[model samples]
Target: MNTSRRTFLKQSSFALAGVSLLSNRLFAAAAASNEITGIQLYSVRDDMKKDPSGTLKQLADMGYKYVEHANYVNGKFYGYAPVDFKKLLDDLGLKMYSGHTVMNKQDWDEAKNDFTDKWKQTVADAAIVGQQYVISPWLDESMRNNMSDFKRYMDVFNKCGELCKKSGMKFGYHNHNFEFSTKLDGVRLYDLILKNTDPDLVAQQLDMGNMYEAGGIAMDVVKQYPGRFELMHVKDEIKSKNPGEMGGGYESTVLGKGVIPVKEVIDYGRNKGGTTQFIIEQESYQDKTPLECAKEDLRIMKGWGY
Candidate 1:
């Protein structure tokens, strides 16, 4: 859909890196046992950009306890240093459980056989801000076109997972429309990624709505890869009036107010897909303001007993 956060990741100089692997058993055991409902801050991108503090307060007041960030630049999260941001969220009874940062070739040094310091710093800051997962939201176009390089980057994704394990966090990948439609050697790109990465280290945060544009069905994916998804971008889709970047004639809308079988698919995810975190994300709000949509989304999720 070419979201604002997606554009930021493309332009920002912030990079990602990895370190040695560690046992994830302990970390996994420490994961939140109860279901968590959070909002991807990108749902209110303009509000966050204008007044991060005020936006956060509004979210907290709406009864949101968790958030998933989409901006981290220059060792800061939305202009606040990691520790400061954590404190700000804590004060408002909110916690950032996950964040999106694009990890590309620049983050990895082939010669050194390791990630650059800049990426290591990204993970470090994620830990400081109490993030349970550091998710790379986009797969660069270059990496996807070549089979060899694509598989190589999948290995890097696992390496990042190992790196995050040392800090009691898990490394994750969030999908766009490409993974479902793109193929290599006749194999779907999404299948290759799931095969290459270790489940204990790397996690999948399925964006239920993003893939609709690519002819992906959330129910089919969950059934095909049961127990693989640990996180989910809870969303609903509808036929778009102004279709552009988001192809397949679809756009995001309020929960359960669209064509997607939102509740049915998410219920399946909970019972079979191993999804514990349901993070709400609505990119196109129809005629409603983003904040209005956010509030309604939270209310709907609660009503559905999330």
Candidate 2:
């Protein structure tokens, strides 16, 4: 064949391939845009007890496409047996992408006799609930008192993270202000936990508002560690009329209206950081119900064009 004809055919094939690739990229972007917003179900812990299935249905109807779980007792999820809740979420058109299950919660229920296999069971139950992450969201007073205590917990965290890895899930730590407020020998316990943990096994679900409450700066943490964070609990805190006598920041109002630089953090997570899921976790339901705050948050996120 002639050289000029051969080159022309090659160019034609390349043009077709580029068009196909651009079409596929547009399709993926459209799919992602279809999901309106997501919420962490801990926002409505009270309503969950009265009516678990009913509450989730309401959330789905309100345009919440994703929900991260915050309840699991024994191998049971919500009050339903393990497998059942997964089916319920599927039926609701909602995905249980993650769960906030720690080593100490209902794992020690005396009648359940499930105390011995605490951490491993936490990972397994997460799978049963269709979760990709099993998040440890708290550290008690003893764990926060010193660096050594935090280090001791890292061993357990590592063990749990390994267990999660085996089950196609990752272990993560969620935070509150206590991690920053109290420190061990001048070192912030939060930083120490990040420094010691194995990155592969442990992921950071850095609660933005809580970190801000702990006296750590928001943009500073994002800039300091580029890719250590995976998930982010998006909350906002209203500074009390008084200072020095503070309450929980996790138990703050919805996003944006409070103090956290949420939109700035969101932009960082997408362009610079490694975070995948940005979950809205509201612990305080004041001046309105939990469901109302969730709707308000969704509105705020839409307003910000996220």
Candidate 3:
């Protein structure tokens, strides 16, 4: 019943967004729609790595019902096996709906025309743990350089989507700044990706903060791809005194406390961006701890009626 209702709500809302793609009515109705909001566990990676139970408990105490994972390797999440980890989450009254696992070109075998066993197993395990989405958070450098290869790899994305579909899950991709700035054959990589992938199979998990590094505007992207996004990384950017990835320029701060029109974006996404999964992620906290940031981000989301 939980999965059914969750899927129905997402699919129905997505259809609404899709219908209002050319209209602004979606934004008008956005705030009234309740959305699934959660935190990306990577925001507390260090805490989790040190004490998975305690870290999860803290998040649960902060009133997070859903979570997305960024740490799953060798059939384990943080350190527990898939089944055990799922139990841990269930015990805390928390659910994990998605995960970030990097799927590179090497994971596919051109000779056999199939994904490597490892990647297949990855998808299978994700289903075992009740993940609705198995998202590859990063694309390797090799997949980005050539137009022909990139397009070919997009086909692989479709195939991965098929593989995931077997487990009643969808394949997803997360973006960083490069997708906006980088171009091939006069086409922005992000645009190409959206154009090429099948929406039913592949979902885009747009990270609003990551695009700031490339000067990409989240509002503009959402408008351009109405009803295309299913998952979103909600973050606000602040000029960072110690920038790392964006050339010492900016990093994430608490929602609404920073420069991004966080509420507006979420509202728009809810109504028109086909976004039902809003996962909070704060990579850089100025004066606050990551856990503190996580708690604050949730508080802000709740205030926004998510």
Measured with C-alpha atoms, the lDDT of residue 166 in candidate 2 is: 87
> What are the runs in model 1 whose C-alpha is more than 4 Å off?
1-32
Q: Against the true structure, whose lDDT is highest?
A: 3
- The stretch of ten residues in a row with the least summed lDDT in candidate 2 is 241-250
TM-score, ranked from best to worst: 3, 1, 2
Model 2 residue runs over 4 Å out of place are: 1-37, 105-115, 241-251
Judged by whole-model lDDT over C-alpha atoms, candidate 2 comes out at 0.76
- What lDDT does each candidate get? 0.89, 0.76, 0.89
Candidate 1, 54-137: lDDT as tens digits: 999999999999999999988899999999999999999998999999997789899998999999999999999999999999
RMSD of each: 15.2, 6.3, 9.1
Error of 3 at 77 (Å): 0.5
| Model 1 TM-score, 2 decimals | 0.88
> Which structure is stronger by lDDT: 1 or 2?
1
lDDT of 3 by residue, 190-214 (tens): 9999999999999999898899878
In candidate 3, clashing pairs total: 0
TM-scores for every candidate against the unseen true structure: 0.88, 0.80, 0.89
